[model samples]
Target: MKKTSDLEEQLKEITQQRNLLLKALDVLEEGIHVVDSSGRTIIYTKGCEKIEQSKSDYILGKHISEAYELDDETSVQLRVLKSGIAVKNHHTSYITSQGKRADIITNTYPIFENGKIIAAVSVNRDITKLGELTEKIIELQKNLYSGEQKRRKHANGTIFEFDDIIGESDSIKQTIKIAKKFARSLSPVIIQGETGTGKELFAQSIHNYSSRANGPFVAVNCAAIPESLLEGILFGTSKGAFTGAEDKSGLFEEATEGTLFLDEINSMSMLLQTKMLRVLQNKTVRRVGGNKEIPVNPRIISATNVDPMESIAKNQLRNDLYYRLAVATLVIPPLRNRLDDIPILARYFIEKNSKIMGKNIKYISDEVFEIFNKYNWPGNVRELEHVIEHAINMADSTDTKLSVQHLPPHLREKFTHKHHFYKDYKVNNLQQTLLDIEKDIITQELINNDYNITKTAKSLGISRQHLQYRLKKLNIKKQK
Candidate 1:
């Protein structure tokens, strides 16, 4: 009786442990699939069901290749079972029994008992979303390159030039001067500026100003692309590089004899930075999973929204790559720093947008300009242009001026709340201050009314004769 009772207890403990292990496997995010020596599925996890869009009951006890609609030669689990070796980090794609395509990065290990391979256990991570996104990017890249090549035969790829830049500020002028000089050289140039400060504008201008102006100008934003695919995009890819990789020319090869603008270069990974540095130094590129070296001579122009030195300190950017790319550097001053240019930029945008929107906006009001000057433009020139565009949209077709009421709601609310009644009032002797304030009010009213004395007097609640007398006393000149 005692021996029988001990045997029952051992059986119960084994059952509990087996159940716990099964629970743990089902809860994992990655699919755990186990197959026997004969390639029959023994264990199929819930994760597998979710990823493959099939039920475990339908897969378990069936042949691994048949369940996943894969062949013995292509199946990682079957390959591991046949070779008795572990395949680590293999990128593969297969169609499920349900006929849905699945992309996975898998690690298949041979399970052994008594030194003989008895089964294979594979851990799989679904990368279908990432794979689809990569495919979309590749398609877009193909379209872009083909379009650019076609356009190159007709005209240059760049649309902007130094003359297109609308800034009279000393800071911008100085930056542009240095950039024009950099354009004459074949040395790599680095542009540093805050976000929305038109780093790409300067890059394109430099490219158009250079000897390579007639060649293809390719621009890619490093920060906008996925790190996993960036290397393949920049260095090209080989036919067998990954599951679906093909023999494709990268940005460097496409930009050969032209200029390749890498915007936000600091966003690139350190590993990619090292590889890029090697390519830059050698003036050639080796495709991913390819052994052949292709020579490229594109004028490399890299930009960073952040300070490269700070990026280096944080280990986000490689110091060596920075030095190589920054042979000639141009720093664009932010909009806040170039406040003197606001009036001109605002006017320029207003005129440009007016023609586009078919509105007759002739000027921005004094109050609107005051708000613009006081509010720091964090998005720099882009934000200013957008603000002007938004204002024009709000203005009536007959409206000759954009006013505070026409400003974007958020900007209007922000600066309007901070505006004090006395903020613009010059404090001095009571009589002089009052006289000055009155003169300013009458002058603004006259301008707002198109210098019509009758409308100004009616708007100010004064007689026309008294308004005329005040205008003369203040020596205010009205244009005919």
Candidate 2:
């Protein structure tokens, strides 16, 4: 009798402990509630006031269904409490004060007493904003295969294959062949290029071609994230690793058995660079404040607009890390070096963005070609995309032709240069130097005239015969 009495006392103490824990949980800033035996929400925490976007005094005694409505699928979670079972991370929708709906994920567990459920405890997390931000990833993916189109990616979206690579140039084709071969190996690869040269596209294409195509293609912008938060974000933290932290997975870990593309990697701090180097060497990562080492087999791909060597010289990136990264590097040529591809790339972007922006774009005019040919595209592919998109918008919506006159003022500057007169005509020491000067002058004249010889000569304040003589003598081919 005495032992059984002592045992009952111990049970009472345990019950008290549970009650105290429940009270502590209710006081948390996170949304938490308790449904007691009578199906009354007996414990209403002010934590939920913010998530429901409601005032603290308004929610205390409301029914579970009365306080929040559910979408079609998550409404079934109500049965879990009724059946005395536990459910977690069940995604549901909530009607906010503005009468707009948002997504909230909940974790619910039934509290048992003497082998019977006495109550249900729930924690709700709002994730609607996060869900929308997640769609930007699809935007990045679409940017890869889209050429000039603006669209977001979805699960059902078509992934890029080798055929999606649009270039007949030998260098581009050879680069693709090497990329495809390396993609099959699933090793770390670095793509080096100037800004807007399609580094992410190549990364995505390589991922799609790899064995890990079915897994997530996680891309993180090292430059975009702040250094303070970057470390925690790259290597996730344990629950309450610091104040207000829930369990979060870092990009490298989240991309387990997949590919993790760290863009503008030179932006990572020196401290984080050391941590990253270890992960690269060990194929493992330790969470912040976590002692356990996790083996990650994700393929690594990094890209940068700035030259990696230059970055290393500035101490932005470690020289040792640079050597590890450049085992197989691919350098993308600027658009000026690949002028033959300009028309093809331009028309592709015009047609695609036109369809998306609902503008009618039919053809590129000879004037547009002259504009394309004369100017060096310093902004590369991305600049071309935006310029064409702007042209589509500025032209008559029904008009299908794009000409030089339609281009913006800034774009016109590329083809414009002030003729510098040498006071002495004998400045050239070599025939090549004179030829070069005359070639530049003739080219400028052609651009000023829209490549029309009569108009060009008139612009140069000279006769067409004189312009033709100089162009021929200098062996300068006038743009057609």
Predictions in order: lDDT:
0.85, 0.73
What's the distance in Å from true for residue 93, model 1?
4.1
lDDT string for model 1 (1-480, tens) is: 999999999999999998899899999999999999999999889989889999988998999766765667768788888899899877767778898888788899998999999999999999889878776865564345454445643255666789888888899899899999999999999999998899877988898898999988888888767776678889999886654567999999999999999988999989889999999999999999899999999999999988899999999999999999999888999998899999999889988899889999998878788889888888999999999999899877778988776788888678654223333665768898888877777766675555667767987899999988998898899755
Query: Whose TM-score is greatest here?
Result: 1
After superposition, candidate 1 runs with Cα above 4 Å error: 1-43, 55-58, 61-100, 105-125, 134-156, 355-358, 396-398, 422-480
Task: Please give the RMSD of candidate 1 to the true structure.
Answer: 6.6
Clash pairs of candidate 1? none
For all predicted structures, in order, the TM-scores are: 0.75, 0.58
Q: Residue 139, candidate 2: how far off, in angstroms? A: 10
